[model samples]
Target: WADGAVGPEVAAAYSARRVRLLDALAGRGVAAYGRSGMNVWVPVPDETGAVARLLQHGWAVAPGARFRLDSPPAVRITVSPLTEADIEPLADAVAAAVRPSPARSYR
Candidate 1:
């Protein structure tokens, strides 16, 4: 669905193909469709067609939820320069502060 160029003809073709696919699915008793952001960013043309096709096929759009957690701010203490003793404590403190959490861990 990544259309490099956007034009009337491309839009029409995309709409037609989407309808055809939906119709085929309907014939098989598949009334629901779930589309996620598989691509890093959805192209504008593809997004338009997707939304139109979903509504045309009687699908309802639902709002997605956002979940975020607030964490305590880190203490910043600037020094002119640091020796090995200063480096070890700072590194240890950072490692402890960055322990894995559900909201902050790399997936």
Candidate 2:
């Protein structure tokens, strides 16, 4: 499909979607790493919690632990099925999952 059904237009669309996802996450101050492809690696405080929280928001993401045990907690989010409209909401959910609350508050 890479050279046949998936032509330049298709590839470009995928790239755009990937970039949009990355930009959205970055805009929220979330450190996501994704130079290419549809998958984005977003580091979080807890991979399990982030995955669960994202699932609660109707997003099914894979925990980084499934791929690497030595790395810090993170979640893998794919932008394959995500449209331009879905980018912001997904970013918001990711941000919320990554930073649930302030580490400390002084009153």
Candidate 3:
């Protein structure tokens, strides 16, 4: 962008990927707060637990607490390095990590 190295097509691709991640997460009933840029913020009940769970799925996300904000617990996920194929799996992992599971009943 600075040296005209980043063209419109490249920037468009980045924007597209970000939107894909946001849409995927929304489809899974996960709320994400990001309209532009490469990072999406997802609010979770427990930031630490969410981070740990996502890590277990091979995805590293930044805990909102790291930002020192007084807002609710959330995680920051960067979508820049993720490919188009990675969106669904990432969204699934995020949804699983952030949303509480229903109690299982053994019959």
Q: Write the per-residue lDDT of candidate 3 for residues 1-107, one digit (tens) a residue.
A: 44667777776777888889999999999999877667899999999999999999999999998865579889999887899889999999999999876789999
The RMSD of every model to the true structure, in order and in angstroms, is 23.7, 3.3, 3.3
TM per candidate comes to: 0.27, 0.83, 0.83
- Worst lDDT window (10 residues) for model 3? 1-10
> Quick one: best lDDT, which candidate?
3
TM-score of 1: 0.27
lDDT of 2 at 23: 88
For model 3, the superposed segments whose C-alpha errors exceed 4 Å read 1-7, 101-107
Candidate order, lDDT descending: 3, 2, 1
- Displacement of residue 42 (Cα, Å) in model 3 is 0.3
lDDT of each: 0.33, 0.85, 0.89
Worst ten-residue run, lDDT, model 2?
1-10
Which of the two, 1 or 2, has more TM-score?
Answer: 2
- Give the least accurate 10-residue stretch of model 1, judged by summed lDDT: 36-45
